[model samples]
Target: MKTVEVQNLIEIGLDGAEVEVSDPQGTGDHFAATVVWSGFEDMSLIQQHQAVYKTLGDYLTREIHALQLKTSAK
Candidate 1:
């Protein structure tokens, strides 16, 4: 998937989240995303990552081969 599509998906899924997605290796399957959202305030690191994973759903392993995620509470 393209970076814009990834960013849009995350932004929509996380509501008011600020999302930035990039293809670091210029490979369509590998992506890096940074997401900032208030929902992560009290969540653990694993939970934070899980939230992103959940947002992507089936698209995770299928369309996206690998995702490097950075998440923070705003």
Candidate 2:
């Protein structure tokens, strides 16, 4: 639930992704992240978001309450 933990999970899941995460309200459950990876190339916006969500997996459903996500292809 910590910001670094979230960042680590995303980085691991997305392989060489560059991930930046922050807790905007200083609350552990709420997060904002920007993920950049070459694998996102050719994917639609929705698909890009889905990939990030999939990386978070069950944490998105349980530990994390909100995620303001932004993604881009490197």
Candidate 3:
């Protein structure tokens, strides 16, 4: 899971969300991302994470070994 690929997936799934992803451990499988989208405003912290997870779909635990997500509203 390259950073750009992850960013693209999130952006597309979240309806053009702004995402910044980094490979913290220099391993493509371990990533950290910060996402900003208007949809997050009414969602709780857990819900926010779930929304991102939904975007990633099956890639969450499979392709992406770990994702540290920080989500915020635009």
Please rank every candidate by TM-score, starting with the best: 2, 1, 3
Once superposed on the true structure, which residue ranges of model 2 sit more than 4 Å away at CA? none
Query: Per-prediction count of colliding residue pairs?
Result: 0, 0, 0
- Deviating ranges (above 4 Å) for candidate 1: none
Report lDDT (CA) for all predictions. 0.94, 0.95, 0.92
Backbone clashes in model 3, listed as residue pairs:
none
Compared with the true structure, what per-residue lDDT tens digits does model 2 show for residues 1-74?
79999999999999999999999999899999999999999999999999999989999989999999999999
Clash number for model 1? 0
Which candidate should be chosen as best, given lDDT against the real structure? Answer: 2
Query: Clashing residue pairs in candidate 2, if any?
Result: none
Candidate 3 structure quality by residue, lDDT tens digits, 7-45: 988988999688999999988899999999999999999
Superior candidate under lDDT, 1 versus 2: 2
Query: Against the hidden reference, what TM-scores do the models get?
Result: 0.96, 0.96, 0.94
